[model samples]
Structures are given as C-alpha cells and as structure tokens.
Target: MFRTVVMIFFACVAGVATAEDTRLKRLDTGDDSRGWEAVGRLDIGGKGFCTGALIAPDLVLTAAHCLYDSLSGAQINHEEIEFLAGWRNGRASAYRWVRRAVVHPEYVYNGKVSADRVRNDVALLELHHPIRNTTVVPFATDQRPKKGDRIGVVSYARERSEAPSMQEACRVMARQSGMLIMSCEADFGSSGAPVFSFQDGVPRIVSVVSAKAEVAGHKVSLGTQLEGPLAVLKAALAQGQGAFSAAPAPRENRITVGTRNSSSGAKFIKN
Candidate 1:
C-alpha cells in the first residue's frame, strides 16, 4: 500500500554542515555513508542509473526522466527498477524493487529542455517494500530554497557511478521560471539526485537534479523545484493515473532520446 504521509524524521540530531568550506567527498568506503544512508542509486533495468532519495520508507524521489528508457523513450516497467539504499564500496544497506512510479502530471517526456519541462521533471517511485533498517532513514521534503541559499547534493554520476558523492558546498545560484540553477556539479547518471536544504540541522530535500547546463558561460546544474510539482504527482498517484498495479500496463508510445534540440539560455545536457 502507498504511504499516506511522505515526510520522515530521523532519530538523532546533527548540525547541518555549511557549504562555505565543504567539498565533494566520494563515498567509496562504508564510513562515508554515515549520514547519507537514505540517498541511493536507482538502477533502471541495468540500462542506466540515476540518483534517488528516500522520502518515505516506500517512496523514492527522483527525476521523471529516469523512468523513461534512454534509447526507446518509453516509460520503463516498475519491475525493472531497483533502489539500492546506502550504496557504497559495491555494497548497500538495502535493495528493493520498485512497485510503481508516478511522474508529475504536467511532465512531458519530449526529450527537450524548457522552462516547463525543467519545472516538472520530478517523479516518485513506490518501493515493493519499505526500507525500515535502523541506519537507512528516509529524508524529509521541504519547500524550495531561496536564491543564493546554500544547498547540498548526494549523487552518483558517470565517472563516479560506483559510489555516491556528497557536495555540501553547492549553492542555489538562481531560481528562474520555477527551475533552480545550482552550482552543484552534476553529470550523466546524476539525474534525479536530491537537492537538499538543511532545516533545523537536518537535511531536507527541496529540488531534484534534472540536467546540467551552462548559463552565461557558467556551468550550473538544473533542478526542478519540488514545492508545486510534487503535489501534482502525489495527486496523480492518489488517482491511480500513473502507477503500476498487479497487472501489467499497456506499452506507451515510444519516444527516442535527444530528439528535440533547443538552444536557449541553458544548454540541456542529460545528467
């Protein structure tokens, strides 16, 4: 069953690390996952992987694009997706298959970068079972951070796909047209990584990595603000519009990747 409440609370209290002096630390060892057990790698049918965060024991937050096949552009089956919590050094605290997934109602998999697309590139994955381990705690979702606010990201990217990396020094460079331009470094396979804002000395997810772009000669990561689109996605899931059930779903019209090319303010590099 779907979890009614999506928010989560951790047991212990740790002061939020400031982004001023923090640098990206690769979690190649078990000790590196002490405070980031909830962040995981979402493997899409062994084709590709994206970063995801646990908002509820059964719910994973990631980019909507991660649910689609990169070559066929069709929505992948939930059974093909798996979430590996606290993945580091070739191990994980927990591994579970996805039962269902719901994308933002307004999101269109058009293979293009636009304000509207970036604004709604969020998705929620329902896990087959909840990860209730003592260490693998889910994170809480919060409102979008204001412009220039210090934010952090834990992600698995192209070169660093084996282990996740924590970048606590990233900042929200700008918020325009409902999208967040962040200084956080993102690359291929980093799509759907959570953008966290520290609240009450805890990490709360505010946005999700969608793409990496160059803005005004400055390379920045693009993210979808979670305030509005997340609600719509939850509603869709409540209505059973975009979720998998016991029976298999009919195949959707396949859309190929990188079909639409838009040369605008941000150069859309799929991450």
Candidate 2:
C-alpha cells in the first residue's frame, strides 16, 4: 500500500531525488546537542516513544499518530505522556508531564496508509507547566520547504533511543498532497521528529516526521506541511476540542489536557 503511494508521488513530481544527503551524527555529547535543546523525546505510556519539539514554552509539536495506540487504535491518556527536554545520557534538561494534547482535526488513526493520513499527521501538546530553563528554549515554526531545499532532522529511533541523532544535510525530494518526501533518515520511534530549515543560521521547524518509506530502494521520510494543518491544530486548542486531563474533576480553566512508517521493498511504515 505504501509502495503504491510512493510510486504515485514520484510520478506526480518530476526529478524527485536526493542530493548529497549527509550521514546521521549521534548527538551523544552535551556540546554536540547544544543548540538543539528544544528537540526532545516524547515518552508515551512507558510503551513507546516519539520525537517532539517545543514550539512554545508550554506547547509541543509532534505527529498526531503518536497520540494513539497502534494496536487498539484508541487515543492514549495524556497523563501517561512525559516530555523529556534535551534528554541525553540518562538525564534531561527539564522534565514535565503532559497536561493536554490536541491532534489535527482531519487526522484519523485507522491503521491504514494513505496520502490523507500523511497530509494531516500533526498534533500539538500542552505541558502541565511551562519549561522555563534558560538553556531549553522553544523553536519557531516556518513555512514548508520547497522541493530540493536543504533540510535537517534531529530524532531518536529504536536502537538509538537513548539519545538523538542529527542528519544535517538532506533534500526535500518532493511535495505531494500537502506532504513532504525527503531524504532525511528516520526509523521506528522517529515519528513527530522536527524537520528543520536553517535560515540566517537559525533553525526553524518546517515539518514533522509522519512516516518512513522506501521508494525504488532508497529510504525516505514523510512529513506534513506545517502552515495549514498547524493553524488548524492551534485553532482546535483554542476552541477547547479534544482536550484531556488526569485531574479528578475537570478544571473550569479550559487550558490543558492532552494528549510512521514505511514503504517496503518499495513500502511504507509509520516511524
């Protein structure tokens, strides 16, 4: 199913290819991860994890599918989620429990792969308390990158879950149906990883990893465009939709509660 999707995307866009992509560098040391403190790990229910970034002191940006149970297709309790900001070598710069979460209204976790799924695969998380550490700052979002634009990804995956890895040079291979196909390295647990565009030497998030895929034997990552779906997610949060809390009684103050893949032999998998 994912192979078909990748093939279709390749056919739709001409000259879809990666150029001089760099190898992944493990950010195992403090100095190696200095400016990327905002990119952190989302530990969910002690079952699995995903990558996420602080877009605001109290808000996190990640893929919508990260909020659901892959087996039950049910939304996970927000209280079970924790954000480990700048986690490395068994310690974190700051730790906070999730207070609320909002998935994109158009995203549906039906356990199927499709363009619609990838296009709307975004979510926003609100922390119980804002991260106020001077070293851990939130990143700003930017418009989606164009095809062939250079980008970078910082993420934690299955075998490398202890720390994040940085892929500093990758290209946007194509843009289709509001999704980006890029040469960035992604794997299981990399879902919700931020795709960064360095403008004026300042890194800004432009997309969020939705899945991992292989097209004609080359590995690629899938992501959602931030500009439109992100606006929708923020609006949903403002409108008080899909909010969850662990409190015994719902608080009158309506602020929080919260809460890919591959292509195969030419296939697709949610990271």
Q: Among all windows of ten consecutive residues in candidate 2, which has the lowest summed lDDT?
A: 250-259
How close to the true structure is residue 238 of candidate 1, measured as C-alpha lDDT?
77
Q: What lDDT score goes with residue 249 in model 1?
A: 23
Across 1-271, the per-residue lDDT of candidate 2 in tens digits comes to: 0111232235544445555747999999989999888899999988889999999999999988888776666788988999999989799999999888888767766765566677788999989999999899899999999988889999988888889999979988878767888888688889999999998888999999988766656777888879988888788878876567332321123111121232311223333
In model 1, which residue pairs have backbone atoms overlapping below 3 Å?
Answer: 191-271
lDDT of 1 by residue, 1-271 (tens): 0001111111111122223755678987767778798999998887889899999898899998887765555778878989999888788899999887888766766565566677788999888899999999999899999877889999998788778999987887767668887778777888999999986789999999987765444445778979788888777767766555443222324323234532223333343
Runs in model 1 deviating more than 4 A are: 1-23, 244-271
Instruction: Quantify how close model 2 is to the true structure by its C-alpha RMSD in Å.
Output: 7.7
TM per candidate comes to: 0.81, 0.86
TM for candidate 2 is 0.86
Model 1, residue 180: displacement in angstroms? 0.4
Residue 184 of candidate 2: its Cα lDDT?
86
Give each model's whole-structure lDDT: 0.75, 0.79
Name the top TM-score candidate.
2
User: Backbone clashes per model, in order?
Assistant: 1, 24
Model 1 gets an lDDT of 0.75
- Model 1 lowest lDDT segment of ten: 1-10
